[model samples]
Target: MDKSYDPFKYSSDSLEDVAEQISDVLKCPITIEDVNHRLLAYSTHSDSTDPARISTIIGRRVPEKVIHSLWKDGTIPALLKSQEPIHVKNIKEVGLGNRVAISIWKNNEVLGFIWAQEINKSLTSNELDLLKKAANAVQNKLLYLQKGKMKKEEREQEFFWKLLTGNTLRHDDMADGFYQLNKTMPPIYSVVLFRFTKPITEKMEKQLNYLLETTQLVHICLVTIDYNELILLVSPKEEQPLNQIKQFLRVMEKQMMQRYNIEHFAMSIGGIYSDISSVHIAYKEALAVLKVKERYLSDAEHLMSFSELGIYQYLDVLAEKRKHNRSPNYPLSQLEKYDNEHHSNLIETLETFIDSDSNVKTAAKQLNVHVNTLNYRLKRIQEITGLDLKNVNEKFSILLEIKIRNMGL
Candidate 1:
């Protein structure tokens, strides 16, 4: 080991220099890579480099084939689990010679890797010890970088949360915050809210974060508002913003289902609003859409948009009006009262009947009841409400009334 080697002296600016120093002390070329195998830094010595290392540097990532080969040989897994340097005697089949690799770690988490190619001779114990010191230096550098990044993300998330929650009012303030985050104030943005049946797991959250980072959208911000919900704000770069969002959401749904086995989830997208200050409007619209989905479109698995909500978009307005004004009691409320008094489910029967498009046989089949029993129930409903089932207008009005009541308005 080099008595003068000091891991504490390196900073972000000196990462490449540290790699060069390690290379000089160990008499081997060095390559530094993130856990994903993306190249971070490498020594300048090129004379003794192998084809794999050269390809990794050129491509900025380790080739998939090389990674697969390493996985098959259990080398990648071993390095991931251990902080000690691992020596590969030979990997000529994958266009590499002998090399020693150490996991750059912090708090038991493997952050990256530092690899030293053993070109002319195997690394001695002393050289391996020096490599460990280099790995510790890289770990410290990564920790510093990660902390800085986390602070920036925290600030951005706070700004985004404030924007969504309508805490920040002035456009200039928002613009300044966006500028601090290195983001522009989007002219128009839409919010998408995800609701999960269960709280998201750490693995699920990590996968979602990775997906958000890798998504092809040009401008986006994702934040978790609750344990079971995630909010995504997107500013589309294309002419058709709605279409772009829908397509991105579809891809996300498929990946979530296929990759993560996430079966019970729903997503609602709000209408696009032009001004940053009006983003809360979009957020409310998204919440409304989610409510509509839960009440009316519970069976739908794809993303629901505010524009597609039809008459239900105005339900929230009606609900508020109903709150302040004394409106006529909904006719469906009469049936609900009767059902509760009698311990019956005439409301469910009526809903199933309407949902089946007024087909008595279909409704009966859906309800798992005999058609005559369904007819008797329909007759009783008409008798109780004095509404004629044969009249189209009456049926339509009843259906609308039932929908509004189902929304708990």
Candidate 2:
């Protein structure tokens, strides 16, 4: 805002001031590099541990090779060319932790760029929002200084998003882009999109990335959403057995609960769908399953495969009462005769008494008889079946037989 102010000095110094404030607030390493690709200023926390000091990096062009490789890959080019800040993943070459890059300029002159590396921690919602606001503010400051250099960058960034989301090109161009994307992946892979009810924190995101890295278990593409959900694209080389995956999921669930201190985030695992494009539908199915939890809460995490839910059958009927009837192959008239001759309300009463676990009072109340009368009926039941109603095994078998015989009749 000062007229005699060096725009570079102002932005870099201002960035350092803001970074320090942010570092104090968030306790993260915040570093700002100038337009010349030199480190102008960094947070005190970063300076303490970083061997490369800002003085050494100031006024030097960042290595051509570093930006060149990224440009060739079209990642950095998209951001730098567009004049817009971008959030990038898998930028391991830049350094450990997640990186956010923003180009800086003022009065149509390129001021430089700022890079913030989230060290040892994932970006929190409030932190990310603050960073985004900070980045845009810095960009606007540059635009105020170097007016009229912003239009191209905006268009380029929009193009990048459309391309990334597969909304930019014709069907053929889309296929080609997908082909290039898949060239880095295994030939036969499966994509599973797991959705959660809560937003994944930076720590959980890093933990998930670490798990995938260590196990070499699944090639995962994680996209965090505003709705506090993760769109995970898991491409496993060669189909993994369901059991092994289930075990891993169980372990992950336990770790998430213990480490993050959150629970009841239902994961709806989609069926293994081959090819990348099918991944979108897989996400839909996973979402459907999560939505249907009311119907399947009894199973909990055990019900991963939605196709196995048999939802229709369940919705149409309650549990079938065990039919204690003879097989259809047996004579119908025989069953009728058995029922006619077995007019022994005594046996029926005994069966009911035993099924009630020999609780004479309960059986008596159920049968509208006295406890002594129910006990006498039970004694006669032991005489007929040669099984003690008092024993659990005997009681279970007798109850089962009674159910079967009832069904037969």
Candidate 3:
């Protein structure tokens, strides 16, 4: 081995060339990935390649489970923290073989990683130094690719915002932007929003972009950041879009919480639309669902769409009317006062009754109380408020007022 060897001095004009060069020097299989585990390049390999490498190359990105395993085992974290090569023993459970990897870095940030599978030999200290050299050689090429990607991303963001804000009236009008970007609009899409408690950091953005780009389960048409919110235009490929979105949300929520210890973000989606022109409505609806979750966090916890809000969907309109008329909810106020003074739960019983669709048995079961107990409470409720329990209008009004009071509006 040359003592003063330089990666740049080798015959390499592209990342693929760098990969093949590294593989030739190390006599092993080689693969390269961006910071998000999306495969960028790999060297021609023999039959000695492991299942993990085969999966990554086939999918053109690392599988989620493999990525999860690497993160959980502390290998990925260590690689991110240093430019030095990390020797990883085979994690047979995740189909990983013995390998050595190093992060490609430009400055303080990691641009990507290069992996050399040790099929038959372990890398000596000098070879470890050689792997580090490979990382250095791969850096500038990755940066050039990244610069082009970022500019395309910026244009997509601009065009998306214009569509969302209703600047582009029809799909036909966006033909030029679509052609210039070399992207196709989804035939069907929904506006999905994730609200974070704090503004997203650059690291978090990279993680999110990685997830969206690498995952095939959910089709993300476009994504952008607005303050503390990460907005995505999701294209559900399944025949039933709602089920697809629900599954996507479950997976994303689990991933964000598990991988990043991120639990502060909540996900919501608007009605699925067939045309881009309806996206403004979808955007508004998504924002509405977000507001519902903000005001009634516990009650709206599982509700991801506007329709799921049920009677609470009219909270904004009700609130608007109250501002003008200022009519106090007399019956609900009386019940709340009685419950407070008696150390009772008359208010809960009433709300539970309404939520159970006025079913005494269901309401009693939900409250973990006896049917007679719930009935007696109902009798007492009617007595205190002098309110008719059979009135549909009255029942809805009570539930609406309770939700409003719960929101402190």
Pick the TM-score winner. 3
TM-score of each: 0.59, 0.35, 0.89
lDDT of candidate 2 at residue 247, scale 0 to 100: 55
Worst 10 residues of 1 by lDDT: 294-303
Candidate 3 lDDT tens digits, 1-409? 7868865566577778888888988889899999888899999999878899999999898987888788889998898898899989899998899999999999898998999999888999888888887887888889998999899999989988987899999678776677778978778889989999899999889878867876667778788999888998898985988889888888888878876788878888899888778888899999999888888889888899866878668887887787787667799879888988999999889999998999999999999999999999999999999888899998988888888778776
lDDT of each: 0.78, 0.51, 0.86
Displacement of residue 18 (Cα, Å) in model 2 is 27
lDDT of 1 by residue, 59-123 (tens): 88777567757766778779867888998767778897788899998886777899898877898
What lDDT is reached at residue 308 by model 1?
84
Give the range where candidate 2 is weakest over 10 consecutive residues by summed lDDT.
311-320
How do these models rank on lDDT, best leading? 3, 1, 2
lDDT head-to-head 1 vs 3, winner: 3
* Model 3, position 262: C-alpha lDDT score: 84
